[model samples]
Target: MPFRIFRRVLQLVLCANALRVYLISHSIRRVIIATLGTALLLQVAYFASVLLLVWRAWCNRRAVEGTSQRRRGSDYS
Candidate 1:
């Protein structure tokens, strides 16, 4: 999946230069760029949310681990 994204971003970077030239020469280019930018923004937002959820779950796991560690140490007494 990430490799697919890497290919997409590579394609975007390679195409953007031509897109800039197209933008200056045609009205249709503006609309295409606008649509692509909006779609890219939405994708980025979704990726951020998934990352945030993973981070939150990781923190909760760490907290549980710490509590279990303390309980184990207390048992030695």
Candidate 2:
């Protein structure tokens, strides 16, 4: 009977250890996924900022060209 009890205790210990390992692995997987998500968001933001800068530059060039054209028209008049 004592041997049987010993075997039961050993089984319980093994089960508990397995549960702990599974939980740890699950948490690690979540951390990795979150990190990847953050990296992707940052990449998207960087691209957006670059696009905004290009748009601003284009607008400024157009404005300058328009002013220069108006000046030339006035001079002709």
Candidate 3:
């Protein structure tokens, strides 16, 4: 019974090692790297869009302020 238990333990260890090796194979590594890179790219794009929106709002605010100043100056003249 002890020998049978030892055999089972050894089989489990071998199976675990095989799984580990398969996970660390080149194709799997490439898939993991690609997934991470795509995620990073998406994050950057989201930030870029947020930055663009803020920039547009700032420009619009500046334009409105400039127009108001022009109107006030024209009224004084």
- Expressed as tens digits, the lDDT of each residue in 1-77 for candidate 1 is 46588568756754774477566767676657665775677578768878998999999999999999999999997
Which consecutive 10 residues in model 1 have the weakest lDDT in total?
Answer: 13-22
lDDT of model 1, residue 57:
100
Once superposed on the true structure, which residue ranges of model 2 sit more than 4 Å away at CA? Answer: 1-26
Top TM-score hit: 2
> Taking the tens digit of each residue's C-alpha lDDT, what string does model 3 give over 1-77?
25576457655654565455557774756555555565566557657877998999999999999999999999999
Report lDDT (Cα) of residue 47, candidate 2: 75
Selected candidate, larger TM-score, 2 vs 3: 2
lDDT to native, each model? 0.74, 0.69, 0.69
Instruction: Order the candidates by TM-score, highest first.
Output: 2, 3, 1
